[model samples]
Target: MPTLALMWEAKAAPGRAGDLLAWARAQELDPSPARREHFTAPGERVLVITWWPAAYDAEVPELPDPPQELRARPVHRWRFEQV
Candidate 1:
C-alpha cells in the first residue's frame, strides 16, 4: 500500500504560541500513526503531521479542534500521497 500524510495546522492568538505548542505536543491520535511530527512557526503557528499506511483512496482520520479561545482561527488540514 502507498503511504498517506495528514497535516493539521493552527495559529494561536497573540502571545499564545507556547500554549498552543504545549497542547499540540500532548495530543494522541487513535488508530496509531506510523510516524508523526510537530512544528512551530513564527507568528504563533503550530503544525502536526501524521503518516499512515493506506491505499490511495483510503479514508483518513480527522483531527479535533483545539480550544476555541487559544486559536486565532479554525484549524487547517490537508492530506497528500508520496510522489
Candidate 2:
C-alpha cells in the first residue's frame, strides 16, 4: 500500500504563534497516523505533516481548525503520495 502524507499549515495572529503551535501539537486524530511531525517557520507559521499507510484519496482524520482568534488566516492543507 502506498503511504500518503498530509500537510497542514497555518499562520497565527500577532503574538499568538506559541498558542497556535501548542494547539496543533496537542490535537489527537481519531485513527492516528503512522507518523506525525510539527514545525514552525518564519512569519509565525505552523506546519504539521502526518504520514499514513493508505490510498491517496482515503478518508483520513485531519486536524480541525483552531479558534478564530488564534489564526491570521484560514488554514492550508495538501495531500501527497510517496513515490
Candidate 3:
C-alpha cells in the first residue's frame, strides 16, 4: 500500500490561534491520528498535515472526515503519494 498525505492551509481569526491549536490537539486523539503542524509568522496561518496507508478501493478508509469548525475557515487540501 502507498502512503497518502493530506495537506491544508488556513488562516486563524484574530487572537483565535490558541483555540485552533487546542482543537487540533483534541482531534489528533480521535480514531484517526491526524497530526497538525504549522508556521505562524507574516500572518496567522496554519498548515495541517495528515498521513495514512492508501488502499486499492475507490475510497480511502484511513483518512478522517474534516472537522466542522475547520470547514468554516478558508482551507485547502492536497493529496500526495509518498516518495
Candidate 4:
C-alpha cells in the first residue's frame, strides 16, 4: 500500500497567529492519519502535514478551514504520494 501526505498551510491575521495555531492544533480529523505534524513559520504561518495509508489520489480526511477572523488569507492544501 502506498502512503499519501496531506499538507495544509494558512496565514493568520495580525496578532492572531497564536489563536490560529491553537485552533489548528485543536482540530481533529475522523479516522485520523497515521502520522501528523504541526509547524509554525515566520509571518504567522501555520503548516500541518498528515501522513496516511492510501494512494495519492485517494479521498482522505483533512483539516477544515479555521474561522475567517483567525486567518489572514485562505488556506492552501496539497497531497503527495510517498516515493
Candidate 5:
C-alpha cells in the first residue's frame, strides 16, 4: 500500500511557546501512525508530522486540536503522498 504524510501546524501565543511545545510533546494520536515527528520554529510555531501506511486517499485519523488559549491563531493541517 502507499503511504501518506500528514502534517499539523500551530502557532503559539506570545510567551507561550514553551507551554505549547510541552503540550504538543505530550499528545498521542489514536490508531497510531507508522512514524511521527515534531518540530519547532522561531515564531513559536509547532509542527507534528506522521507517516501513515495507507492509501493516499485513506481516511486517516488526526490529532486533537490544542486549546484556544495556547494558540496565536487556528491550526493548519495538510496531507501529501510521496512521488
Candidate 6:
C-alpha cells in the first residue's frame, strides 16, 4: 500500500485558529498510522499537513474535511504519493 501525504494551506479568521484546530482534533475517522502537523506564520495564516494510508483514498472520507468557517478562507490541498 502506498502512503498518502495531504497538505493544506489556509488562513483562519481572527481568533478562530484555536477553534479550527479543536475541530480537526475532534474528527473521528480512522486512518492507519495517521499523523498531523500544524504551523502558523507571522500572519493569521495556518498550515496543516495530514497523512494517511493511500489505500483508503478512493473511499473519500470526511476526516480530511476542514471546518466550515475555515472552508471559506483560501485553501490549497495536494496529495503526494510515497515511494
Computed on alpha carbons, the lDDT of every model, listed in order, comes to 0.86, 0.97, 0.54, 0.95, 0.90, 0.64
Highest lDDT model number: 2
Q: Estimate, for each residue in 1-81, the C-alpha lDDT of model 3 and write its tens digit.
A: 677776665556666665655555455433463343544443556666766666323243332334555433656667777
Mark the 10 consecutive residues where model 6 has the least summed lDDT. Answer: 56-65
- Please give the lDDT score for candidate 1: 0.86
TM-score of 1: 0.89
lDDT of 6 by residue, 1-83 (tens): 77777766666767777776666566664543377777777556666677776653544343455666764475767767777
lDDT tens readout by residue for model 5, 22-59? 89888887888999999999999999999998878899
Off by over 4 Å in 6: 55-57, 60-72
> Which numbered prediction scores highest in TM-score against the true structure?
2
Model 4: lDDT to the true structure: 0.95
**Stronger candidate by lDDT (1 vs 2):** 2
Runs in model 4 deviating more than 4 A are none
Error of 1 at 61 (Å): 2.9
Q: Candidate 1 at 66: error in angstroms? A: 0.3
Candidates, ranked, lDDT: 2, 4, 5, 1, 6, 3
Each prediction's Cα RMSD?
Answer: 1.3, 0.5, 4.2, 0.6, 1.0, 3.2
User: Which stretches of model 5 miss by more than 4 angstroms?
Assistant: none
Clashing pairs for model 1 are none
For model 2, the stretches where C-alpha displacement exceeds 4 angstroms are none
For all candidates, what are the clash counts? 0, 0, 0, 0, 0, 0
lDDT score, candidate 5:
0.90
* Tens-place lDDT digits, model 4, residues 17-81: 99998999999999899999999999999999999999998988899999999999999999999
Candidate 2 vs candidate 6: the lDDT winner is: 2
Better of 2 and 6 by TM-score: 2
TM-score of each: 0.89, 0.98, 0.61, 0.97, 0.92, 0.61
